[model samples]
Target: MTVKMTRLRNGIVIVLLIEFVLALLGYIFISSKTSLVLATYIFIKNIIMLALIFYASSLINENNISVSEVLNDEAKNAFIFGGLGLIKYDKNRNISWTSDLFTEMKINIVGKKLLEWQPLLASLFEDDDIKVVDINSRKFEVYNSKESRMLYLKDVSDYIEISKEFEDQQICVAYITVDNYDESIEQADEQTAASIQSTSRQVILDWAKDNGVVLKRYKSDGYIAVFNERTYRKQVEDKFKILDIFKEQAEQLGQVMTLSIGIGRGSNILRELDELAFSALSLAYSRGGDQATVKSNDEPIRYFGGNSESYEKSNMIRARVIAQTLAGIIKKSDNVLIMGHKQSDFDSFGASIAMYAMCKAYGKKTYIIIDYDSLEEKTKTVATNLCDDERYRGVFISPLRAQELNMSNTLLVIVDNHKPSLAIDSNILDIVSNKVVIDHHRRGEEFVELPLLTYLEPAASSTVELIVELFEYQKEEICVTEREATIMYTGMLIDTNYFRTRVGTRTFQAAAKLKELQANVGEAYKYLEDDYDTTLTKLSITQTAYRYGEGILIAFGKLDKIYSRTLLAKAGNELLGISGVKAVFIVGKTGKEEISISARSTRDINVQLIMEKLGGGGHFSMAACQLEMEDVTRAINLLEEAVNMYLDERKSE
Candidate 1:
């Protein structure tokens, strides 16, 4: 009924009959006394042998390969492929057969599933693609064929090693600078200056030699380090220990000069890598130095260090030039609009009012873009009072009103924040073309692409400090009304946390100038004071604080109620004044699914780095982040993890 059976019946059957007759005749001839019984016995013996041969051939044909072919061709091919092995498995993952190479390797796979013999190979049954696996300390590339239920494996240990070696040898570029070199050197005594220069010169060269980085000093305080991926990877593994080296040297000699490093990787072009390195260096430089920034292709920028106070700059010439430039632009524009960040705080609104006074002095019409319905109680009260005045009936306008205005040749000034997403109404940016950014917060990666003018000085106590400085260089004699001066003073007071942080000589001078303008300090203090119920709530939040590290404090608000962003910040500020406290975090609920964390520090630790781990950023002293889940416990847990990670990174060195 089968093909082999038909072969026997068509031709092989006739041949078998002839052979049987011949064998019977020869036996009869040899016998002395032959009988009919003897011939019948010989026929039966011949037929039995023929049936056995047919059965053997039929079994071999089932697999579509003869036994001789399988034993010869497949074995020869397996040897030629250099450690190639083939396995055939059924739907149940049982190994039905294996090539001769498997037996040569002494791996008994025929009677067992790979799940028992080699679990890694079992993954091949789930997909029809090549994968690498380890077997007996050797690497193999396995190609799976789902249609045939077969797996082909070839040794790939040598190839993988060569690829790794190539990657390790790839080039990386770096830029380094000594932070505060020029300022401190000019102010130091002769002997101290000499020591500073010598220390700066030797420390970096010694590090470069030890780390195998090729260093070339281009300027007195700048160097370019060229190294391979292996050396760069060493820094990543150690968390950039160079930052500690710089910090230690500064502490030993009083911070004459510290270091900032920027690394660029994942580029084939040397010039592009150099540009990326410089870009990364600028981020570290802008963030107050004593840090390292890494900018790799297609990866988000990363920051480390910044554990110390940033050096301050007081450049009057730069301020004078920016003021003159801004005056020219404002006088030429048809009108102007001043905008601050969302959820307007004292500093943000105060800076906007200062800029508004300047625009009015220029004799040009300008409006402050604000969402009045969302304004703080004190700020809204101020706006309402000003609206009642005859001199400022149309000064405060909503973002929607600004959008409806004729915007031709309008100049937009953004105060207190540079990131567009934080703008009072981010949609205003789409309608306005000419823009300028002014802020005192530490720089982040998000920024307006191009602007007519920009001033970002993190050293200043507040943006109001910078605006007050610009007041001196204006061509037209501009005088802010008494109320305007009071509002501007409030901005500076709140941002500096009562002149306790980021204060400089210029900050006091600006405050004195406002005092001369009859700015009421009493009114500014009143704005900072919280209502009775809010004060009690803030105290409760701060009182629940527990210690984190040596000087860090962590606390939370009522889990069932919503608190203002300002409330959490105020609680964090109060906790910073506690005995021996260096940093504070106040966690609270803001929305149904949003949890807010406000962080503050006293220069003993960098809170920005800790908060950045949770996707929020701010100055070294203050920062905040949000978690999108409703679980207050989870928010606190994540904040603790961030704190632990930050301390762990610093502790490693």
Candidate 2:
């Protein structure tokens, strides 16, 4: 006999036995109520009922017919009636009893709880609305009753499969581009050039064919592909291994060749999907490329693989163009206000001051918005000096005052940061109609929307470098006070970590311009010197840090005391230079209700992506994040998990 026949035979025997026991119990109860003498016959009555049921079962077993010959799949053709099965359990979810329909359905519920055999049913027991689940290759609609401690399961596989079929056929669009094709191809020889061109094409074509995507190449470096939702889901399940394919191929080519892939789905409109794909691709480039960014209709954009730092652009044309546009916006606005990230450091403060002078050169009323209460000890000195200067009196204002000023045609120039949430006063952004962003950090998903001009150069050492270049293209000449030039030079010094970090040709050129303006190097260095207490904190971090696997170090400060963001960042930077430590993550309490992390890495690691996973972003070498947790130990646990997860993903590739 087949397995189904055995199951059917067992189920029949069990059901007949249950019925026989129940009937004997009813007969025994009636006899006991009649007379004491009849109670003695109760045991005999039960044996007779059992014997009768066994004889009937044996007669059925003697027949030659099997269950397959007796019934169709699901026993649908054999049964004239079908009923929903009822199950009851305690609050602990242990199985107490099940109705007869469960036996007919071939479910092995004997001596088992809901979760023991039906782990998927664990969540459905929450007493929520009716939910659908799959059990034994059949779909079920589950309805729960907490008051009665009962659950109702009805098979609905036919309707569920129809809905699933429709869902799997939804359209998905992907836009792909060779990230460094223009630059890489210009330098390659014939053999290598052919590999970058045709080999790159074959890599994508093969993957697309494997994934059931219709591939079309529109440009030498660009392509468009289409696939269904089922295929797209499988790609996500595999963590978008196309990124790993590109990484392996680039290794063989011995050059910087990578791809940016943007996929858009969850919508039927083809035009909307195309637009989304394009937008996602642009975002991927802004975030330093070498990745796949998937954007769904109403969902957050998901990122995969950005293990490499963005390559620097060699041209200054884009910088000059942005400078001209910025100058025009400055000339048109009635009044301009400059702001930076919270607790503005020398880089942020210097960029804002330079912008202040640039706007002032346009002969427009401009003020640098700052909050004195939040200023660092070093920035307070810079602010005090500017106030004492004859040229800068009444030039600096608070964010509150900037917002209260006449609101018409006002220009907002945010420096050193693009994300509004990171601003000193995010609310100030809402009142200003025209805005400009000057930043050197890699772009993240959050951005200042529809700015009048955005000058973002992640490759540049500092925002001040971009500002100094803009000075060459401006229509008006900006005169430098020795104090202003010193601030600008200090911004460059701080961001580049005193010229130890990445420094390029334009970085030096910008530094040369500052030197010519009589920016005293001695004065710039004075602002970077930390107090004795801060020095102690920075030293403690490295001493306390413990090594994590794969050249990562983890450290945290006392939970009872609050540490400055600058302190944590400086500690991370210093720890990164130590031998055998490729990346350093320093965690500490920044506020009574908040914990913060400062992550720094060498060229071998990408700390920015790690921080982004923890709700923060910055350059590949440096980044930070703030969490709402008060316990430093708990925060360290989360950081370890993120590091392990990132490392594990790379290992898998």
Candidate 3:
């Protein structure tokens, strides 16, 4: 039992003993022969004395009251001995009574002022303790009696300070890595490499010194930083300026550089700290690097420093390994089902068809999953031509049929997109245990989890480029037919905008290999040709374009009938031809209910950030988003708002 309860029990026992003794004395003093009047007088006197003793014992048992002040200043003694301050407030929160401690503290609380303090008091009630700054700063354990309009506070300042000091002394571990270090330094001369490495190391060292952090360079391209909670918080608030500094210095040296930073905190166990730091670093790299990711023991992960573009790693050796792995997985499956994102476009169809051809060569049954009802015009035309061929008949099926044919060994290969929500049918993911993902877009939060094999290269122009690389590394002789070659080349053509943007050396090499397989560029051009009505639509959309935010152009177009996404993208490209335009955004509706925006920019701006804010993602120069709104004007307004916010943030930085 508690101390107060034990004292109350002892007091009750003492009171009972006194009462028993008094009753015994009354019985002894008044005999059976005594008169009724004498016995009644004795009984009354004993009862009065017993009541006085019980009251004195109750005073001694009271937790907040003292025995010495039973008759002298009960309230004053309670406050002094218990080390508590009492404040009573009326309905309006005006102080009705203040104890001696409350008065000495000189708290200037008025009617509404007490309401201002309610949040702190409520937090204390919920947490059992809170820190407050009044006439003097102190930590308190609070007890509140709402019915009596009273509050009690007990001092705990010393204990709170000691706990805080221990927390501030705990160490946080951080791992820093320079992304694509080998690719960046391999081509440089010895002196140039040394200079770049020195500058990068100096920047990190200077930042660590400024923030009171300990740094050690244990590897040529990596560092380990140790700091306390205060320094970590300051680095988070500053958005890890070392990222921007390193990028700036590398650019001056005629090289592109990016850093991935991972911080592990809120754990005292050394093994767990190491694991958290490694997890954070992996997340940063998976998100395309050039960012800082923090993981704490009890909190959700936090992100920063992703405003810049990610440097691409053109690792052919990694690609070859991935290709071989994919072949092995495909051979082991019972059947293969190739799928892509919603509203299938040329890139999606091309990658699916290429996979189909490879599976056919391996003598494995395969089907391409597409939503025929939602195909764009050009993609629909290509699908029609492939279906007309007798050899390619029944190769294309809908998501429903694919599910019906799904088995335990069925392999699902997702191409051109990684987000589960953007899948043709997200339910397919649950049915298939063996899965593979291949895409060229920058990674986002929504991605497939735990695939058998994943080949994602944001540097490639299109998924077709990656697939072509796979075909090159295949061990057996594989003949990519003329039609398959044409389809794959067309996908590359569309994504690279007729070889005008996002084309790398590998992109050209893939195109050359496709030509060697007799891919007809002339036929591909014919497939991309626009009719008279579509040409007039593009002209009208371009005419509606207006300049926004220092040479960024925005256009709003409404279609009487649902048009192809390719046409919408073509309209956006038209606006970029203007001499002064640095970026272009085109908003339109694909059907009765769906609204979409296509974003494009030059090297001066980053359009991916703007689209990501609207719940979509892509490369730095090209991105798109589909919204639920029906009104075209509202979509345009939201687009402008995102653009302005992005520009304003850049300016502030």
- Model 1 per-residue lDDT tens digits across residues 1-653: 46866676557667777877876786777763464466677588767866866676666566555555766766666463687878888888888998777776677878787678777766666654778888777788988787898888888888899998998998999999998787778888999889888987788988899999999999988999999999988988888888788768866878546788988988889998998899999878767788889898978888877887676765577799999999999999989999998778778888998898899889889899989877766777777787888777888899999999999999999999888877889888878999999888777888866789888877788899889889999988877888888988998887888888878889999999888888999988886777899899999888778887788889996776888888898899888887798899999998898898999988778887888789777788988887888988899899999999988888885
- Minimum summed lDDT over a 10-residue window in model 2 is located at 74-83
RMSD of each: 8.7, 13.6, 6.2
Worst 10 residues of 1 by lDDT: 31-40
Clashing pairs in 1: none
Top-down lDDT ranking: 1, 2, 3
Ranking by TM-score: 1, 3, 2
Against the true structure, what is each candidate's TM-score? 0.84, 0.81, 0.82
lDDT of 3: 0.79
Compared with the true structure, all predictions reach lDDT values of: 0.83, 0.82, 0.79
Q: How accurate is candidate 2 locally (lDDT)?
A: 0.82
Q: Which stretches of candidate 3 lie over 4 Å from their true place?
A: 1-86, 93-102, 110-146, 150-171, 216-218, 265-273, 296-301, 559-564, 591-593
Query: In TM-score terms, which candidate is top?
Result: 1
Considering TM-score, which of the candidate structures 1 and 2 is the better prediction for this target?
1
| Tens-digit per-residue lDDT, 398-455, candidate 2 | 8888878997988999999999998888888887868899998888888987888878
TM-score of 2: 0.81
lDDT of 1 at 298: 78
